[model samples]
Target: MKRKHPELYEILVKTYQQDISESFKVDFKALMGKLKERVGRNSPCPCASGKKFKKCCLRK
Candidate 1:
């Protein structure tokens, strides 16, 4: 997974830990939106697919 989507892996680990609060749901959505905005179409899919996000799991 790391080899396929290093950026997403890094962010996921940095964002979520052992325990999260209920309020984190809001924060999580914001964080994910920010991430999607920050990532490029050429970036590897967060799902670990070796294809670009536009050609892989990204919703049309």
Candidate 2:
């Protein structure tokens, strides 16, 4: 089917890829937010930096 309709196949592939990427971005952000909430402001940064969460990546 795809070989018989290369243009349609390409369009479908591009649309599906875009939709998957957008969904992943949303899920990743939500996951990060949950993880961030689990870490305390005064806790050491997850990156192993001696700095506190509030002073490190949290500031970003």
Candidate 3:
């Protein structure tokens, strides 16, 4: 979806961030940091696309 529709993907991501922040009172940056710690840049992406995180979703 992201590759085919980058603008829509960004909008959805922003909306999701807002929803998470409002509903859980969570800090999105901090949450992303924790997630980044768990996934090495050279490791396979959590999205299961068989590509390294840095070359895949991390590009976003």
Candidate 4:
């Protein structure tokens, strides 16, 4: 799939990294700030499940 869709592959990979990395101890305010900067509430979810942001990651 990645070879067929490099752009999408990149998005999926980035999203995966974001999810896993969030589990580690990190700055609170800075992380939220970065999330807001990078992920809009209505944007496609970072989970690679084709769901909207508000319906996915936000629910967690």
Q: Best-fitting candidate, measured by TM-score?
A: 2
Judged by lDDT against the true structure, how good is candidate 1?
0.67
> Compared with the true structure, what per-residue lDDT tens digits does model 1 show for residues 1-60?
889999999988888774666555344344446564566778986555588887865663
> Which of candidates 2 and 3 reaches a greater TM-score?
2
Q: Tell me the lDDT of model 2 at 58.
A: 70
Candidate 4: where are CA atoms >4 Å away?
1-37
Question: Model 1 compared with the native: what TM-score?
Answer: 0.35
RMSD of 1: 16.0
Which ranges of candidate 3 are over 4 A from the true structure? 1-37
Error (Å) of candidate 3 at residue 12 is 30
TM-scores, all candidates, are 0.35, 0.38, 0.37, 0.37
Q: Against the correct fold, how does model 4 do in TM-score?
A: 0.37
For lDDT, candidate 2 versus 3, the one ahead is 3
Q: Name the top lDDT candidate.
A: 3
Q: Write the per-residue lDDT of candidate 3 for residues 6-59, one digit (tens) a residue.
A: 999999998877745456554534545667457779988766669888887675
Each prediction's number of clashing residue pairs: 0, 0, 0, 0
Candidate 3 weakest lDDT stretch, 10 residues = 24-33
Any residue pairs clashing in model 2, and if so which? none
